[model samples]
Target: MAKADMEQFIKSQLLKADLIEIDRQLSVTGINDMTSMLLLKQAFITVSNLVDFEITIRSIYREHEKLSSEYKSSSKNYEFAKYLRNKYIGHIKQELIQKSIEWKPELRYSLKRIDEPGMMFIFNLFILETAINTYVNDDGSHKIFESETDLKYPPDLKRFLIYLSSTVRSAISYLSNLANAFGERVEMLDASEQKIEHWIAAGETRFEFIKK
Candidate 1:
């Protein structure tokens, strides 16, 4: 699929969910708006914030200077800065979980869980899920885990595990919701769509105005 077609698919999916309103000319304006909406929904990343370690490391290493400058409030580089901030913050959280366990041995204590990337990914997944559930209709009680198990809060291993598990689960759940809406299996296919490149090449990326 092309970018336009992919956006069209997204819009159609959202429409199927009765989640958004598109104009009559869905071929043009609707797809554009829908693309923007999905970008906003995913917060401009192809996946959630806790990306795979290899990609994350490469991204940070290659873009560190640009990212660091973005972090500096004085610069007008708002987008890159925000990206760095969010990603680094997520990194910090992961580190904290890891350190918490290390603390156990030195202090002759034990923590609830290990701070692995899968767990970190799950944590981010939870945050996204929380935001989505809140947006879907303001139902906040829809938690990733229904039970108040051992790790129900921070500083506790069981709670952290729940948090991580919930994160991964939520991504899956919301994506499933999206798939049902678009009438197509949208997972991982967004990148394969060629229309996005076509639009960029033609400099017709604006949603409100596309030169037909």
Candidate 2:
């Protein structure tokens, strides 16, 4: 393959590896009242991973102008995600932080408030709203919340997590297909297969295909 194609293929594969890690971390469950703080941390990590995935996808789009239709359709999600990344995750606004504290005075009592389930739920909900536009009711009206209790421990938390996982898996599948397509079109470096086999044999056993 040409040097440019080789570089692109390698980058795509790296991004695929990242998505795999993100998926694994996000798949961890068993979040109950006792583990709420841990769950919040995991959820925060998942959202950060998702933002990184969006950024990587955007980079790929810039590198290769032509992409599949499904990839193109995700542009809107990435656009909103970029906004959320900057506003909430990447560079949180002081105003927002102050508001959060004012809304929950207990937040001022300890640093652990950052990992509180309620706070984390709001952050996750913000990201989800950005990605999907709006949260709504069956009547096509926007969902309204009067207080934290109105959210009721985020009843849709599982659904949001499932959506995030599905999105990552779909992206990985697309990238895998793209890599295979490129492989069929060009001869890889002679040592590539051996390197892959060695890496797999060295105990990356979680990848079922590699073990196969």
Candidate 3:
């Protein structure tokens, strides 16, 4: 594909879902922000990989063009040969897109506020949110500060922090494996059964052709 064509195609995918107008003060704001950031980060990596793919494709075409010119002869069928080359190029491009999509992640994030609070719950949130910080009573609510507290994070924040940390690690690993699979990436919105059926059909056909 042309550079402009590839860029436009990639841009359309990114623009499909965007984080807009977030309610920052809401209780669920933190989880939303984290999810948005993760999605954006994944998109960024995919775009970078797309660029690498474009460069590789261009190089292949340049080499193909050189060889095509060298083999052209009055007796040799140049038009037929060119058609074969173009078909091969299209197949390669499809494979590249499929691989890139497979590697992407299916991420889900959730947050629930506990109305029935306890001393332990409060401590855990405090610890995770403000690591190594000591809480102080201020206006009947607990507060932790950087300069005053011996620890920055309190125990209350611990569970949240651990959850976020493990989530990030798992997401990265899942994405890496998915990308390495070298197949079309499915979206959360896509019908799972239909997609699987298509893949099975394609795989069978490909296997049959290879055997022949």
The whole-model lDDT of each prediction reads: 0.34, 0.51, 0.32
Candidate 2 residues 83-155, lDDT tens each? 4455555666565565555555544665566587566555444333432323335765544322122222466
The digit string of per-residue lDDT tens for model 1 on 1-212 reads: 23443454454344333212212122233212334333233332322322321122233324334433322322222232234235433333454434334432322231234264344434433333323222222554423334322222344444433333333333333334434433332345366665666678688644576574
Candidate closer to the true structure by TM-score (higher is better), 1 or 2: 2
What TM-score goes with each of the models? 0.25, 0.53, 0.20
* 1-115: candidate 3 lDDT, tens digit per residue: 2444444334434322221122122224443233543342333343333333433334333434542232222112222212223322222235433332333211111113333
Model 3 stretches with alpha carbons more than 4 Å out: 1-32, 59-212
Better of 1 and 2 by lDDT: 2
Query: What ordering of candidates by lDDT runs from best to worst?
Result: 2, 1, 3
Candidate 1, which segments miss by more than 4 Å at Cα?
1-155, 184-212
Give the deviation of candidate 1 from the true structure as CA RMSD: 18.4
